[model samples]
Target chain A: MKKMLLLYVVVIGTLMAYLYMVYFREDNGGLSENAGLHGKTDERYVMVNFLTGIDYWKNSLKGFEDAAEALGVSVEYRGSTQYDVQEEVMVLEQVIARSPSGIAVSAINSEALNAAINKAVEAGIPVVMFDSDAPDSDAYSFLGTNNYNAGVTAAREMAELTGGQGEVGIISLPNQLNHQERTRGFSDTLAKEFPKLRLVGIEDGKGDQLVTEQKSLELMERYPGLTGIFVTEANGGVGAGNAVLQAEKIDKVHIISFDTDKGTLDMVKSGTISATLAQGTWNMGYWSLMHLFHLHNELAEPMPDWRSSDVPPLPTYVDTGITVVTESNVDQFYAK
Target chain B: MKKMLLLYVVVIGTLMAYLYMVYFREDNGGLSENAGLHGKTDERYVMVNFLTGIDYWKNSLKGFEDAAEALGVSVEYRGSTQYDVQEEVMVLEQVIARSPSGIAVSAINSEALNAAINKAVEAGIPVVMFDSDAPDSDAYSFLGTNNYNAGVTAAREMAELTGGQGEVGIISLPNQLNHQERTRGFSDTLAKEFPKLRLVGIEDGKGDQLVTEQKSLELMERYPGLTGIFVTEANGGVGAGNAVLQAEKIDKVHIISFDTDKGTLDMVKSGTISATLAQGTWNMGYWSLMHLFHLHNELAEPMPDWRSSDVPPLPTYVDTGITVVTESNVDQFYAK
Candidate 1:
């Protein structure tokens, strides 16, 4: 009898221990600690943009690569060599043919690339937009600066530089949606917030150095009291700075510009531009890849038929963010 | 000798299989399939706000609770019964004493709550701001509507409704930062884009229904040509709607309002208010918790000594997002 009792106790004891190990470990939210925050090495992602040769893409690409490294995945950077919508569409079509795990695109023209993006989505490939967006397309999310807010930031910074009182002008790419919003924001904030700061003239720079310089000169002549100027693009910033320098009005005029391109940063350093608004380009790249990974892996719970659904699994828009870069902090923006 | 060789081969084969399972499983992001997208049940997060009784906070709180549930965590909602800054500060202090996993706050005053927020951060707790923000505070991230952009969205909607023409007026809480930005956005966009849509007057609503109605009447009386009115808060929206309804000017005037609170939604549904701007309040709650979770779990790579560091581990600002709600879409916004 004693031997039989001992055998029963041992059997029950072992069973109890096994059950405890299987059912009672609650430290990891019901998941094994080793089961998260990584992906397969073969899972490939691609980023496509127009005007691929500009230094503007350096930070964004680095961010994409960094995210790929963190997630243990591979990434490729592809885009049209020229700034043509048709070329970009063709490149996207080719990328969709290979059907890399996912694609992040900066559309050259908002409406022109919808067909290609839609085709990729219909084929079960996930897509997200960055920088420039095709809003009507089926992209899961848009990661970029709120250009209007960027304009507001610039206006605030300009107020601080110009002591909230001055005649200001804008040199912008009027044809582009992003620049139009920026110009509106800068002009509006000035009208409402700084009663004394008058926006005198807005001239299109055509996004060219010489044209921007000419526009800056013309604006200065039209409003000689124009003590402040805001350039909505990097090349225009340098152009406006040159105009101010040649006119010997560097001290008399203050300028705020956009982006952290090397030329723009150099102007900021030399006080040709008082400050520039730097978009969260790196965040755009990194978060775009992250969003793509989540969707591709089905880790982010998508709404039922999310493309046609009222809501999406991911945030529809992620404001990558913006910061004001002035002489004090401009050095950190320089590429190492 | 053949039998001995067979035994050696079997043993070596078993060892190789074990090694492969441990080192080469690449299906996951180098993690176990069951790991990630979850957290511990015992971990608690708290959401703090100023007006605890208002309907404005319902969606945001729901979002916070939803995120907590998804993460296998618990959440507590706490706030001041009144709008007093001191009361909010004290409530936050109380929340800090308990040392929950993280805290999300919607600050009442832009500058008054900085010390309390910094206190929470100093105590080695993760903090994020949602909805309203104290920009100078040491919170890890701010997830809120970019009020300026919210204004811009409203302005565009107004243009669409008014056929980009006619006189419009604003009724708003001018003292509040959010409303000021909205008013500025509406007025600025009107002045720039809709040259024929003149912003004839701006009246302080004091966030009161009767007061707003009186102001609306005053505005309409003063500017007989006024064909549109934008109210920057829910109460004022309904009030403005009532004024138009009573004056029998519903057909002549279009109203654009802010928020999707029940009152606002009902008005939109009834066609009393032509449209309202629906802020990404839910996104604010969800992303705030996500940010705090990453910070608490050390999943987000923070700058060394991020408290004093110029850089943070996470994105500093996130524009939760915004959308337009008219009669056709107002039903979708009603809380189930």
Candidate 2:
């Protein structure tokens, strides 16, 4: 009977101890020592974009890596070497096959990448679009600059440079989503805000410097009163700046450009371009990874049928924001 | 010897069991059973806004409550009884005194509430500005519709309604941050985007229907060719609509306005107002809380000296976004 009593005490004590540990955790409100602000290092995420080697993607990549570090997770960067939509789509499929924890993409072609994005999401992998978006896709959210708003900023800047009274023209890649939105925003703002200023022409730069230069020359020749030009891309900005300089119309025509590439920044510094618009590229990368991490962990709920719902657990869109860089702020934009 | 051997077995077994549990939790990447998508119910948050009794605050308040529920945290709604800046500042100070986990504020005046906001931050309370912002304050984030962008949307809609050609005017409260941004956005867009549309006049509405009506009538009389009106506030929208209707120019003069207030909705439904821009007020509340939660838990790290840092953990500004409500979508705006 004494031996039986000893066994009972031992069993009961162990059971109570285990229960106490669990109860303590529950009482502490889910903040058990094991639960922290960190994730598993093995949990991996991937960021995919087109024109993989460009400096424009550097800030965004840094943001992604920073988020990975914060979350204690691993990340990989993969993209097409050039501006080929098919190649980007293929790369996305390859990444999906490897089945990372989540994927963040900057779609090269908005519609063309929908199938692959949808496939990944349907297979239970969370996906988000950053920098550039394929809006119609099943990707959960978009984190990027609102291209239209960016254009409005450019137009307002152009108006300021020309004293709100001058004829301005646009040189842009008319086929690109970002460029189109910028053109519309610039044209719309110019028409509604500065009645004294007129949009004299809109010519497609075809994302080529030579083409933009020729288009700029044609516009200048066609509209002698054109006192300003807005280019929707970096190459076009440089091209247009060159055209203005070669034609001796640099000072006479104020040029507002996009991006802060070395060439574009040089023009802004040299007084060839009045100013340029810089996007929140880094924010795009950081927020995209955060969103993916949340969705993957089931920490976010999409507000069931969010299409009809008033509010989603995650924002449908996040305008990362924009900045106006001119000669005064141009030095900071240059690569170290 | 037998008794001693039995005691050693029990002791060693319990130790191994405890060690195994701890090791398992760590190996699973801190996702212990106690860890979840929730916080302690005692972790409370507060949301403060001016004009607390108005219907405008209802949706935002609901969003705050919803987020609190999701996070298993307690929340309280507090604000000033009227659109009084000093009163709002007092209310914010009171909330700060209680030392809630966080506070979200919609400032009544852009600059008047800065001191109160700064005090909250200095006291170590995470404060976020929602709907309206004090840009220079130490608040960590501003989660709301970009008023300037909303104005731009209004301008674009007005141009479409008036066939991109007409004389337009604005009715707004000049001193309000939101109204000022809307007016600037509208005027800038009109002057830059719609070359054919002329903004003839801008009048202060004082947020009173009668004053707005008087201003609208004066504008119509001043510009005999006026074809559009963009009111920056709901009362002004309704007042402007009434003036156009009474003047027998409802059909001749298209009106684009702000908000989804019943008055604005009724005008849109009855065709007195062509359309109204609805802000993402709900998003403002939801995101503000989420940001606060992250900051309170130290899950986010705002880059040291974020003012000079290229990237901060939190976005400086979030354009919650806007929706254009027309006759077809007017019914949805009515409170159920």
Give the CA lDDT, 0 to 100, for residue A163 in model 1: 89
Interface RMSD of each: 8.1, 6.7
Cα displacement (angstroms), candidate 1, residue B30, comes to 8.3
Q: TM-scores for all candidates?
A: 0.73, 0.66
Residue B159, model 1: Cα distance from true site in angstroms: 4.9
Among all windows of 10 consecutive residues in model 2 chain A, the one with the lowest summed lDDT is A29-38
Each prediction's DockQ against the real complex: 0.19, 0.13
Tens-digit per-residue lDDT, A1-336, candidate 1: 566556556655655664465355433323543323566767999999999999999888988887777667889999999989899999999999998999999999989999999999989899999999999998877888888878888888888888898799898989999999999888888888997898888888888889989898888888888889999998888899999998889998898888888999999898888988887777788888888987887655323454454445566777766778888878778886
For candidate 2, write residues A1-336 as lDDT tens digits: 577668767776776787687667556634432333345656899999999998999888988887787667889999999889899999999999999999999998889999999999888888999988898898877888888888998989888889998788998888888889999999899889899999888898988899999999999999888899999998888999889999999778988888888999998898888999887777788888888887777555333444343333466677777778888878777775
Candidate 1: pairs in clash: A34-B32, A35-B32, A38-B29, A39-B29
Model 2: DockQ score: 0.13
Per-residue C-alpha lDDT of model 1 across residues B1-336, encoded as one tens digit per residue: 556456556555655664465345434323543333456656889999998999889878888877776566789999998989899999999999999999999999989889988998999899999988898988877888777777777878878888888888889988999999988988888878888888888889999989999999888888888888988887888889899999999988899988877888888999999998877777778778878887787655323454454545576677766768888767777877
Local accuracy by lDDT, each model: 0.82, 0.81
Task: Specify the highest-lDDT model's number.
Answer: 1
| Fraction of true A-B contacts recovered by candidate 1 | 0.19
TM-score (chain A only) for the predictions, listed in order: 0.89, 0.87
